[model samples]
Target: MKRNALYAGFFAILSLPVFSADRKPNVLLIVADDLGYGELGIQGYNKDIPTPNIDSIASNGTRFTSGYVSGPYCSPTRAALLTGKYQQRFGHEFNPGPPVAGNEPIGLSLAETTIGDRFRKAGYATGWFGKSHLGNTPEYHPLSRGFDEFYGFLGGAHSYVNAGAESNNPVLRGREIVKDPGYLTEAFAREASAFIERKKDEPWFVYLPFNAVHAPLEVTEKYEKRFSSITDTKRRHFAGLLSSLDDAVGSVLGKIRELKLEEDTLVIFIADNGGPTAQTTSSNGPLRGFKSQTYEGGVRVPFAIQWKGKLPAAKVDDRPVIQIDLLPTALAAAGVEAEADWKLDGVNLLPYIRGEKTEAPHDALYWRFGQQLAIRKGDWKLVKGPEANAARGGTAGKASTAGAQLYNLADDIGEVNDLASKNPEKFKELAAQWDAWNAQLVDPKWLPNRRAGARNRNSAENSAAPASKWKSGDSFEDDQAPQIASRAFTISARVDAAAPSGVILSQGGPQQGYSLHVKDGKLALSVRVAKQLSTVVSTEVLPAGSHQVEAGIAPDGGVTLKVDGKTTGEGKLASLIQKQPGEGLHVGNDGDAAVGEYTAPANFSGSVAEASVTLQ
Candidate 1:
C-alpha cells in the first residue's frame, strides 16, 4: 500500500503503551442504522454477509451477546447513547414528529449534556460524521450539540446515492450542504479517517453513525459486483451495503493502525437498532419482532468494543448491557470520573470488562417507546408492544398496558415462549418495577415522526366504538377518544384547500389514527393503524374550490383516499389501530397533537365545511 504525505507525520505516537496512563485514549463510536443482530459474522447467525472488520472488534476485545439499545428506533437510541441517560427522562421518548402533544423543541433537549460535550470539555477534538438524527433544526445540528465539526446529514435517514442539496435530506459539511457527497457510507468512513488524521496530535472523539443497510437499499456498482453471488435482489443489495460498511470500517481501522494509534483508541460498535427485515431483508436471526418493537430482536443488537492491549481478547460477555453505557465507559477510558448529578442511565463498563467487577454493569434495564415498553432484571424479562410498529409514534394519552408478556431471556432469547401465565408473580413483580420507573418519566417533548408511540400509562384495554363523527376542533381525551381497536373505520371531510397547507381534520394524533390534510398544495391522507403508516397523496395540487375528500378503510385494513369522488390515492395498512389513540380528534384545526406534518394548532388556512368519521 502507498502512503500519502498526510500520513507521513504519524511516526511519533506509534509506541504508546496500550494500558498507559500517560495519555488519554481517543474514542471511536461507530453506529450502524437498523442493523440486524444476526448480520454480523461474530454473532454466528448469518453466513451470507461477512463482517470481518467489525467482528475483529469482538474477537480482539469484548462482545456483549445480550447487548441492547435504549430504544428500538434510530433517534431515541442515539439520544440515549450521546446523553448517557434514558431519553424518556427528558421526554425524548419518540422520534421527533411534528410538534409533540406538548410544547418542546424539535430535537434533543438542550438542558441535557451530550457525550460530545463531555469529551469536548475534556479538551478532546470532537467530531460527528454520519447520521445526525438528533434534530434537523439549526439548534440541533452536531456543531451546536457540542461537536466542533460535523460532516453528515441531520435527518434520521438520507439518500446514500443522491446525497446532495437536491435531496430531501442532504449531506452537510459542518452547516453547509455538500453539493456532491459521493456514497454516504464511504463518505462517512472518509470523513472519520480524515478527522483522525487531522487531529492526530490531540485526543479526539469521533461519533461515526453510518446509515447503511437502511431503506432505499442502493449499493455502489463495485460493492454490488462484490455481492453478485446472492440470488435475491434485496438480499444481494443488503450484502453489498453490509460489505461496504465492513470495508469502510476496515479502512478507518487500517488508518489507525497505519498511524499506530490503535492502542490509544477506545472503539465501540453497535447497531442503532435491529434491522427492518421486511423492508431491507435484514435478519434478526431467531429473535422475534423487528425494528420499532420492544423485543430482543428490536432493542437487542450486535455490540462490540476494542481497546487493543487494555481489554481481553475474544471474550463474550453475556451480561445485559445497553448503549447508554457507552458514554461513561468512554469517559472512564479517558480517565474522567462521571459526576453524580449527571444522572446517566449508562455505567462505566471498563471496570467490569477489566475484571474489576463480578456483577453485570446494570441490575435492571428499562425501555419505553409509546405503546410498547419492557424491562429486564437479570434472566427474567417483561415486555409488550405491537409487532413491528415501523412508524415510531408517541402517545399523548395515559400509559395503558394491559397485556404485558413475561419471558426468561436465558431460556427464550427468541421470545417465542410466553411465561406470563406460568410466572404470574414474576410478571407482576416486573410490572410493578416498571410502573415505578414509568412514573418517574415525563410526557414526550414532541410527538412521533409518524403517527405512532401512543403509550397508555394505565393498565386498561377496552374495545368500543370511537367518536364516529365530529365537526369541531375540540380535543378528545385519550380514554374518551374514538376507540378503533383493530376495527375498520372511515374519515371524510369537505374542506377548502385554497391555502397552502394545513390539517383539515384528524381523528388520532399520529401513529395510530388517520390524518387528512394538505401538504405542499397536495391533498393527502395519512392512515396509521397498528403503528404502521400508509400515506396516500393526490398527484395534483388542490384547486381553490371546496373539495370533498374521504378516507375509506376496508375490513381487511385496506385504505383508499378520494377527492370529490375521484380516487386520488390508495394504500393498505397491516391492521387497524390496536388501541385507541391517546391524542383525540382535532377536526378542522389540529389544536392538540399534530395529525400530519403540520405543526400543532395546525389550523387550516382554508375553511372546513364538514368533517366526520364512520366506524364499521
Candidate 2:
C-alpha cells in the first residue's frame, strides 16, 4: 500500500470517537529504561522472573506481542515517543551527550510539538517524572518543553540507591537539586502518585520514564531478597532491580484503584528499548542481540495498554505496534484532532483495538543506527551492516561482500536463519523500499563514535605524525601513530598566536577524541570518549606572542596542561579514547569535527613553528 493511503486510512479510522466527548481519560505513560522483552512474566519467555504487577498491565489490558521502539537506544526512542514521529525526520537520531562548554545545544529540536504540548493545549495537566534524557539545556528542560511540572535527572543514567549532591547524576524537583530520597525508584513512584493525586480532579498527562534496569546494578535488600533464589550474581541483581520497578508500577496502579480513577485513566506500560543482556544479565529471551543494534532484541520491547471499560482486556495484539503510536493514540483518547501539519509517522491504534479494523496499523517499520540500517515489512526483515551478526554477539561480516541478510520473523523469532539466498525477490523489494525511505531522512544531527566494533581508521596509531608544521586547515592522514594509542603520551607545539583563539592540536570526532585548543585566549585541553567530555582550561590567557603549549596524558588517564614550562591545568579521565577518528589529526585546526562543543575545523589563526608527539 502507498504510504499516503495508509496514513489517510488511519486518519479516517481515528475520526471515529473512541471515548465520550464530555470526558477525557487521564494518560499515564510509564517507560522502563533497558527493559528486556522476556523480563515480564506475561510474555512467558522467562519463567523464573516474577513480575506480577507489570504482568497485570497486560492481563487487564491488551498485550502487544510485537511491540517495537523507534530507536535501539533510550533518548532516540523517547524523542520518537514524544513527537509521535520518527526521530530521524527531526534529526534526533542519536543519544545526545551531556552539555559541555562549547557543545551546549545538544537536545530535541524545538520545531516539533511534543505530546505534552498537545495535551496541554487540549486542557490537561502535564507532569514529567523520572528520566529526561532528551536535553540538558535550560530551553530543553521538560518544564520548557510542554510539561508544567518536572522531577527527574536530565541525563541518561543514574544510581538507583544513592543520588547524592556529589553524584554525577542528581535528582531534581523542578529545577532545584533535591536530596536523594531513600531509593530512586520508590521516590519516582511517590512523585508519580502525587502528580496523579494533585490532578485527579482534572485531565492530566503523566510521563513516567524510569531509569531502573539500565545499569549500576545496585539493589537494596527490599528487592534483593525476592531474587536471592537466582544463583547467577548479575541476574540476581537484575532481578532485584526489576522487582523494584515492578513495585513502582504497583504503587502507581494502587493509587489509581484507591482513587477510583481506573475507569477514567489510560495506562501504558513499555520499555524504552531492549536490555543490554551481556552487561546487565537481562534476557531478551529467544531474541538475538541487545541494545544499540537493529535486531528485534534491541528494538522490540514489552508493550501494553490498559483502559478499564473503554478497551477490551486479556487480548493479545499479534500485529506490530511502535512507541510512536502512543502520541496519536493518547490524542484520540483525549478527543483531540491531530493536525496534518504535525506529519506524525504513527497511527491511532483505537480502531485496531476496538476490532473495527482488521488490518495491521503499519505497513513497514524502519530503523537507522549509525552505519546499521534495517527495514521490516510484514514478516520479512532486511538488515544491512553488523546488526545482523551483532545481535548474535559476533563480528558483523561486510554487507557489501556478504550483502544484506533476510529473515522471516514468523518462522525464526531469534533471527538465526538467513533467507536472503532463498528469497531473492523479497530481499530486493525490502532493500529498495529501505533505500527510498532512507532518502527522505536527513543526515543524523550527531553520529555516534563507535559502530559495532568498527573504529575510525583516520585516528589509528599509524596516522600519527612524528613532526609536522601545519597551516590553518591542514590535517594529517590517519596512520599507525604510537601516540594515538590509549597510553601515556605528550603533545607539545610551539606557536605564534595571530588570533585570540583556535585549535592548536586535535584528533578524533565529536563522539571521541582529544583536542588542545585556544578558546577565548585561554589554552584548553578536551578529551572525549563514548560521548563524555572532560576538559581543563588554563586560568590565564596567552599574551599575543610565541609560546610553547603542551598536554600530557598519564598512564592513569590524568591530564596535565603546560604553557612554556609552567602547569596551566590538570584533570583526569577514567578511560581514554577507544575508537579512532574518521578524520585524522590537525596541528593548527580541529579537522572536520570538533572534539567538544567548538565548531568543526576550528581553524587556527596562528602559525606553528614545530609540533611533536611523544609516547612513554
Angstrom error of the Cα, residue 321, model 1: value is 0.6
Displacement of residue 339 (Cα, Å) in model 1 is 0.7
Model 1, poorest ten-residue lDDT window? 387-396
Q: Across residues 183-284, which tens digit of lDDT does each residue of candidate 2 receive?
A: 888989999999988777788899999988887577898777888788887788788889899999999999989777888899999999888775577788
lDDT of the candidates, in the order given: 0.78, 0.78
Measured with C-alpha atoms, the lDDT of residue 447 in candidate 1 is 61
Q: Cα RMSD to native, each candidate?
A: 8.3, 13.0
Counting clashing residue pairs in each candidate, in order, gives 24, 11
**Candidate 2 runs further than 4 Å off:** 1-21, 97-104, 165-168, 385-402, 449-455, 458-616
Error of 1 at 8 (Å): 14
Q: Tell me model 2's lDDT, rounded to 2 decimals.
A: 0.78
